[model samples]
Target: PVHAARLTYEAMRVGAPARRLAKSLQPLAGRCDARLVYAYADHASALAADSGPRLLQVADEMEQIGALRYATEAAAYAADAFAREGRQDSARQAAARCRALNARGHGAVLPAMSELDNNAVMLTPRESQLVQLASQGLSNADIAERLVLSVRTVESHLYRAMQKLGVSDHHKL
Candidate 1:
């Protein structure tokens, strides 16, 4: 019941929530109760509506974790898939699940899911902050204002972050 409610809420947005849920939870198919199975289906439907390709990847992961019934295995599969695909939408969804499963409630399913690879040159704290904001799609002017730095400074930070990450633009980050 609790899981159903949670799945419903998650499916409330972007439609086809159930599809994503289904694919993501496929590995737990027989292990989960009817309520959870329904919730998983609903979530997969939701994912399908928002991003079909991503849901496909989620389904792939679910298949990999086969009958494990462990959140860590689920998250590990997600993180690994996200790393391989570099899909922001899927990574975000997987990250959310990892965080949720790590919470005090929710059975504390996954304690140490593998961390996503961060294979880039290091950034200073300020540069890291700027990169974070940039990844969120904030404009240079907006980021500068928020950080109380000049636009030129913000641009410089962005430039440095991109260089360190071995990328030519912000989108790669």
Candidate 2:
């Protein structure tokens, strides 16, 4: 089942049509591992098709079955899809799920998830403050002085924060 799941994901990544991939996954569907993978594949397909509700539903099922990583990723996808569809409430709900999963140490630090308006970059409080100051146009040295930290420390904080935010530039903060 795991092998089948890996093949399914690999096939999808290589641009196979969803119907073809679904047919391939069909035989493995009755197995537990394969079912989890199928749920993930379905969630991905729903997201690609802009089916926000279906995406969320599949994500919820994944989470219920303890597929934490996939569930978290699905929720993030659902959030983005919902936002694009102008379903603000649903988007917020999905974003909240992503945040919750991350907080519980289930989700990866995903840049795409950070793009959601309601989803703040996952940062330490100090990092958050540093990013806020940087966003206000404070120079690193000036921010260091304002925060009473050494310039090197400020730069380190900024670098780590940017890394966590999946951004290459402070301006993106």
> Per-prediction TM-score, please?
0.33, 0.57
Clashing pairs in 2: none
Q: Residues 1-173, candidate 1, lDDT per residue (tens digit)? A: 44654454345332434454556455554455654454345435434454434443444444444423333334444544554555655554554454444442344333324242231133578877888899899999999898788999999988976765445777655
lDDT of each: 0.52, 0.70
Question: What's the TM for model 1?
Answer: 0.33
The stretch of ten residues in a row with the least summed lDDT in candidate 2 is 114-123
Q: Which candidate is the best by lDDT?
A: 2
Model 2 lDDT, full chain set: 0.70
46-110, model 2: which lDDT tens digit per residue?
75576767767877787788876666767777777777777766776777777677666544676
Candidate 1 lDDT (Cα, 0 to 1): 0.52
RMSD of 1: 12.8
Candidate 1 weakest lDDT stretch, 10 residues: 111-120
